[model samples]
Target: MATLLFHLGRASFRFRWFVVLLWVAVLGAAGFAASKAPTPADEGFTMPGIESQKAFDLMEERFPGAAADGASARIVFIAPRGEKVTAAGNKAVVERLVHSAADGSQVASAVDPFQAKAVSEDGTTAYATVSFAATADDLTDASKSHLETALDKARDAGLTVEVGGDALATKPSAGGAAEAIGIAIAAVVLLVTFGSLAAAGLPLLTAIIGVGISMTGILALSEAFGLSANTGTLATMLGLACGIDYALFVVSRYREERAKGRDPWEAAGLAAGTAGSAVVFAGLTVVIALAGLWVVGIPMLTKMGLAAAGAVLVGVLICLTLVPALLGFWPNAVLSRGARRNSRRHRRKQLRTENGGSRWAKLVVRHPLPVLLLGVVGLGAMATPVLDLQLGMPGDEAKATSTTERRAYDALAEGFGPGFNGPLSIVVDAKGAADPKAAVATVSKEIAATDGVVSVSPARFNQAGDTAVFSATPSTAPTDTRTQDLVKTIRDERADIESRSGVSYEVTGRTALNIDIAEKVQASLLPYLAVVVGLAIVLLLLVFRSLLVPLKAAFGFLLSVLAALGAVVAVFQQGHGAELLGVESTGPIMSMMPIFLVGIVFGLAMDYEVFLVSRMREAYVHGDAPKQAIVSGFRHSARVVVAAALIMIAVFSGFIGAGESMIKMIGFGLAIAVLFDAFVVRMAIVPAILALLGHKAWSLPRWLDFMLPDIDVEGEKLNRKREVAERVPEPVG
Candidate 1:
């Protein structure tokens, strides 16, 4: 593998222009393909066999138009402060807006709120409903424009009109601003680390190119795969960070070789054979972790995992091929001019015999017990919040105040009740009943009498008169625990309705569906955790060929992941510092966040584990005491880990500005995880554990050793040649 990679690197160097132009062409083609791709409708995050899915499917089968296929918006008109909304004026505004919106191609019908008594007691507020024939995601930009225009028509005469709900929700910001911010921060870090504009720029350029290709692929695949539109932003986050980090590792190694008086092509070949190998293994770990999301069998998560894994794989490819090609174009100036002058003066100066990381490792070696205990206690403190972490979708309460969704949500809550924004749908299958309408009416009255119910609509039967639907509003906010309890209450009340009225009841609506999703996701957490953690352990065991090493690494990784999630729980769930990011209050963590974080953070944790441990293992294999190897290995690899972690943090943090609160949570969670894992777990915990374990950390039983295949991630042959060359002195000179 080393020989093949060496030859590949030389070939790329010899044909650098072709390599560069080929990537350019591929990127252009990807963009064109993405531009031509179709968009998916608003698909629920559902698993086929789950109860929530069963309910949704039954609802759609019995009542197709009112189920998951339709989009509804609430248009609220409130009189300005100190003004009253006259009945006639409110009627005129609602009628005009409804008529205008109903004329849109996408709109199916617009209901006058006045007719339904959707007006506040003080006559200060009124709201109308606009229903779309298609799902929210199916509405085109033109449809939105028309609706906005209609909404604005009611804004005159001291009326403050706003639109909200599935149809009028704001799309996430374009993400360009976030990407730019991340790239700029990365450039500063790279410039400081390399002290060469050209060298620093290479990683950024590689990242952009890689992310461009990956996002294009994600967008192009969305239509066929039913991927969420948010997949592109998520893919971009991972792709750009990994792309830059991969190239940075390879390029850093190449520059080190150049400093040793090796020719550019030789340096490129050696770097490709060594650091390039580590990049491959590390990237594969990430891909494996991401792909494992498919095991959960949720379509949205499955597609997101596949798309993100593809992006990371692209990063690996660019690092292996494109990075060296670009490096070939600027060999001598890869480092600062000052560093080059210093290298010339100390041509025979061997590399560092001791560094800061090694000195820190020595301290750990002396007090491993205390260091390990401290590390555990600190991580445990951070992870305490996970115990209280709630899992559900963030609602309008978490949105920016400037958004129409938030404004409308507030207005509706003030006018009617919090649950007015997310009414529950009661679908009754009444085929078996002698009189279907009577059965539905009996169930509706019974449901309206249930505690916590604010109101229930009269039953509306389908054309067949076999399926009857009622909209029920609760008194609490949709995301509130009380509201979720109301859904359970209604579902549990189905038995009584079936017995008394001979009708089967099912709760199906956005809020009810979200509750079901949250419950199922929580239930699946343990199995998913087992799968991801088991995979990481087994893969690391194969790579390192040491039982204790993989175990130690896995335990430390779990700690880091827990601590990262705890940080998110603090900010987004516990409401600490959430206001800094425009979040007004605490809420449930998004259902998929924990699963996604577990997968992503586990891979990233293993990335540092592989890079740091590979260096230590290489030293130990060649000839060094375990303690010495730990110190030496950590000294050499710490800088790269820190650099990569910083770059990832910057990239992930940039997405906090995204329009969706869920994306913000993901971005913040990932950034904190990287920061905690790289700096705290990798730097402090692993070294302390290794220091305590000593030789046993690398020991494998004879049978297992024989069965396991050797994976040389550091190009052992190259190290041997260098060692042999050093041993053979120049006698004549």
Candidate 2:
């Protein structure tokens, strides 16, 4: 692998212009394809093989044009404290708003609150449902504007009005000022690390170009592949972070080679062969971890995982080819001025001085047991909160109170009950029953008597009268545990109901769908972790050629991941310090958050592991003592790892500024995970553990070692070949 990469790097340097132009052409083609592709569809929430999904599919089949894919809005109106919406004046305002809303572009119909019996028992609040002909994503801006105008008229009449539904949900934009801020911080970190503007800017430039290509390609193929609208988000975040880090590693290695008196061209090849090998392995681990999301059997998550894996693959390719080619353009500019001007004797003298990383490594080595204990105990304490973790799909209640959606949700909850915001749809299949109408009525009566059910609407049958649908409102909030139990209770009692009424029923709706999704995701988490972690362990064994090292790395990853989850639970779920982070409301954590955090954090955790541990392995292979190898690795690679981790943290933390609760949770979780993994686990715990184990840390069974392929990830073969060539006497001409 090292030899192959060495040759490829040199060729790219020799043919720099060709490589550069090729990438530019690819970028342009991707842009053109994206421009011509159709807009992505807004598919409704679907969980195939689940009861809720089965109910939804049956509804779509039985009732044409009544699929859940269409957009809908519930405009809630609240009269003055002393006045009832039933009063003549307040009633007039409500009727006018409904009429105006019905006239809006794309509106199918707007129900009158009085006729629909949507008015609250108190007579002070009412809500009208506005149905749209198109899905939320397909709704025109003009239609949204028309609805907004109608809302203003209602407010003008001294009534408090708020609209909530899928129609008003906007797609969150990426690459906003927050991302810009992250990139700026990354640039500054690079500048300080490299001490050369040219060197620092190169990584950022390559990363942006790579991310642009991946994002455009995702956009171009989204419609054809049925990717969700937010598929590009994970791709963008991983692409930029990994691209910069990969390039940074290669460039840092190239400068180190140059400092050793190698020519510019040879330095680039050596850098690619050495650091590039690690990059390939690191990139593969990330790809494997991400792509493993497919095992969970969620289509949206699968698309997101594959898209992000592709982005990481692009970063690896650019690091191997484009980085070397670009290095050929200005070989001397990348080197620090101090290094370029220093004499060989002075350079050697400077290298002998102890650096901070070396001192830290030495201190840990001196007190390995103490350091290990402190790190483990500290992280374990942080991970305690994870035991109480709760998973759910947070709804409008999780949104900021300032959003109309949240306000509307609150108003409805207050007017009726918490469950009014998440009514469950019950579908009855009475096609083979002796009397369909009697069976439907019996089923509705049974459902209304369920413990948690507050009310059941009249059954609305299909044209053939074989299928019927009704709504059952629970007494708890959408995300409440009681609501989930209510859904399960109805399903559990279905057998008895069917035996009595001769009709089969299924429960579905936004609430039930969310419940099912959360259950599925939770069940899949362990399997997903097993697949990702087991595969990564094998990959690490191949790279490091050690059994204990891979196990240690995996264990460290578990600690960091758990700690990160614990932190997320405390802040986002338990509401501790949520106000400081802009969390307006607190509830259960997003169902898929733990899986995402584990997969992504595991991949990035391996990145630091490979970079830091490979250097130590290289030193050990070259005959350094175990303790000395630890110091050598820290001295050479510590600075780059620190800078890369900071860049990743900055990029992720920037997303905290987004308005979307899901995005904010993702960003915050990723940032904290990276912090724990990079600093506490990799930097501190790893070194201490290695020091405690000493030579045993790198040991592999002889038979197993013989079975495993030697990929030479540490570039031992390349260094040996170079040494042999230099030792050979030149032939006289």
Candidate 3:
């Protein structure tokens, strides 16, 4: 196979220019179309599955009065301390803020719905509900700025003001800083990883194009299926991450072959044959893992599964087709001098000699038990911090650092009540029981009395209504341990509520849903991870045709996970790098991050495991003993692993420096995992243990061996391929 690959690689080198040109035209076309592609970050988009949208639609359908008057912007006001606010003073403040909104015209037209409403039963806290001429989704910047000016006018007349809620949160411009940081960090990583200013720039560019297209498609698509705004950003970011990562793998491999003296065409072909094959395998693996999210049959996870899977599949194809075609035009642009060298046999010989290794080798060769035990102890120590991780997924509320909206929520929670932030919404739908209103009120009363209750809002739409979405705040802030505790209290109180004579309620929304999602994921993550690990072991066993190789890889993978988890617990959970990373520590990592880290790190770890061991196996196949093969293989591949790892580390750790709290875990986790997998596990532990195993490292029972295919990555025509691979006169170093 290597002989054929070499010949094909040679031919590709001859036609390198053609291949590079092909890549250029394809990329050019993709870029042109992508530039015009739409994204969902537009003002017209609706927040799907929102009851307010439904209520507004129903109201429009029934009376059309609400839509005609447009919607209201909430104007919150706090009265001065020790000063009593009379009805006249409240009315005066409202009228003045209202007039400012209308530019001195009739105040009703600009703030028709503005009314003095008690935020608390006491007159100390009052706010104006100011309706605007625009739909909730159509609020202009001028309109928003107008509100700001009006608030200033009210403050000038002596009132503390804050403006927020659904309207402000839904602005199309929100999260720009966070998203910008994510993109900028991604750009630098891509550039450095590919080792070319232009080329690295291209992967990120292509990913952005793909994201724009996907976002637009998702918008149009979601309109059909009623997906939400959260899905939009989630899908967009995920599409970029998967798309860019896939392209990087393929493009990097192609570049590697080119650097090895293969012409563009040959490098492309070899890259296709090796890395390309792995891309298909890896892409499929991603698709399968994501698709399994649906197997548990949860709505959110299922949708997420399909969205993520679709994104990865699309990315793989773009990498395979578009990237290759683009490369067809840049022959010497990405190529370097290494490809001109002759085969280096001594390095190959040293690598092969590990299989038949010497006396010093006997230490590592005879100490499998000690190494394995030491590995266990190290892993255990690292895993100790994992017990302290608090699993909580922050919502859209936490996207900003110093945004007034978030700060206002925090301040409100502090002064008004603990649960004043984004808490669970409980909707009670009454049955045929008489006095249902009284029963609903009773449930609300009980909820307000629950432990950790900061306070509960007055029953929305009156206590007796069959449908009520009452807001419940907790003693702790939203998405914090207190809220988590509050959610548990609500769940614990569910049966008690069921005993309410006339009403039944289903609790849902950000707070309750956090607990639900976390519980579901926690219960389900183990199985998915087990499947991932089990499948990986099976795949490695098939690839290496050895039990020991799979076991070794699994051990290395375990160490990698512990090492990452430990570092995460120490830095993020233990608040070690908060200021350095420019993020306030949000204790308890996201539940999904660990699951994601496992699969991703494992795939990458297995990639190195396979690459290193395959070469070692190559040495063993050439008649060297197993000990020599292990040492020589590690010595040769260690630098490559370290180089790739350094690139990954720099790229991911930049996220830690980006000053966004949301992505710190992802960036820091992946970087630590890569470093651990490369140096401690792959470099030291994996080699030591494997070397100790000797011939058993490659041993498979004869009967079982027949079921496996012989994979000669070196080549099919062994002697001929050996001559070509061993042709280089000097070692790479």
- Most lDDT-accurate candidate: 2
lDDT of 2 by residue, 1-733 (tens): 9988999898888899999999999999999999999877756456687888899899999998788546999899998999899999989999998999899879999999999999999998999999998988779999999998988988998999988888886556343788779878988999999889999999988999999999999989988898767898789878988899999999999999998888888999999999999999999999999999998888888889999999999999999999999999988888887777876764874578478788888988889888888889988998998998888888889888878889999999999999998999999999889999999999999999999999999999999999999999999999899998999999999999999999899999888988888888889988998999899999999999998899999999999999999999999988888888888988888988998998888888899999999999999999999999999899889889999999999988888888778788998999999999999988899999999889999999999999999899999999999999999999999
Of 1 and 2, the candidate ranking higher by TM-score: 2
Candidate 1 — which pairs collide? none
Best model number under TM-score: 2
1-733: candidate 1 lDDT, tens digit per residue: 5556777777788789999999999899888988898764546556776555676777678776555547888888888786656657667767888889989998888888777777798888888889888877678989989998877777765479987878977776634598579867878988887888888889889988999999887777778777777666557767877788888888888887887778899889888888887888788888878888877777777778888899999998888889889888887677766666875544443455666778887888788889889989999999999999888877787787888888888988888878887788888888878998888888999999999998998777777889877899999988889998888888887887789998788887778878887888888778877787787778788777899988888788889899989999999988889888866667899988888788878777787888888889878887889889888887778777888888788877877878678878888898899888998889888988888888999899999999887666667876677668879988995
Instruction: Point out the higher-scoring one by lDDT: 2 or 3.
Output: 2
lDDT of each: 0.82, 0.90, 0.61
Candidate 1 regions with alpha-carbon error over 4 angstroms: 1-4, 15-18, 21-25, 28-45, 68-72, 80-86, 89-107, 132-153, 174-179, 219-230, 342-351, 658-660, 721-733
In model 2, what lDDT does residue 663 have? 81
Error of 2 at 65 (Å): 2.2
Candidate order by lDDT, decreasing, is 2, 1, 3
Q: Which stretch of 10 consecutive residues in model 1 shows the poorest summed lDDT?
A: 343-352
lDDT for 238 in candidate 1 is: 73
lDDT of 3 by residue, 119-202 (tens): 555555544555555555667767667667777877888877666554455433323455456456556655554446656665
By TM-score rank, best first, the candidates go: 2, 1, 3
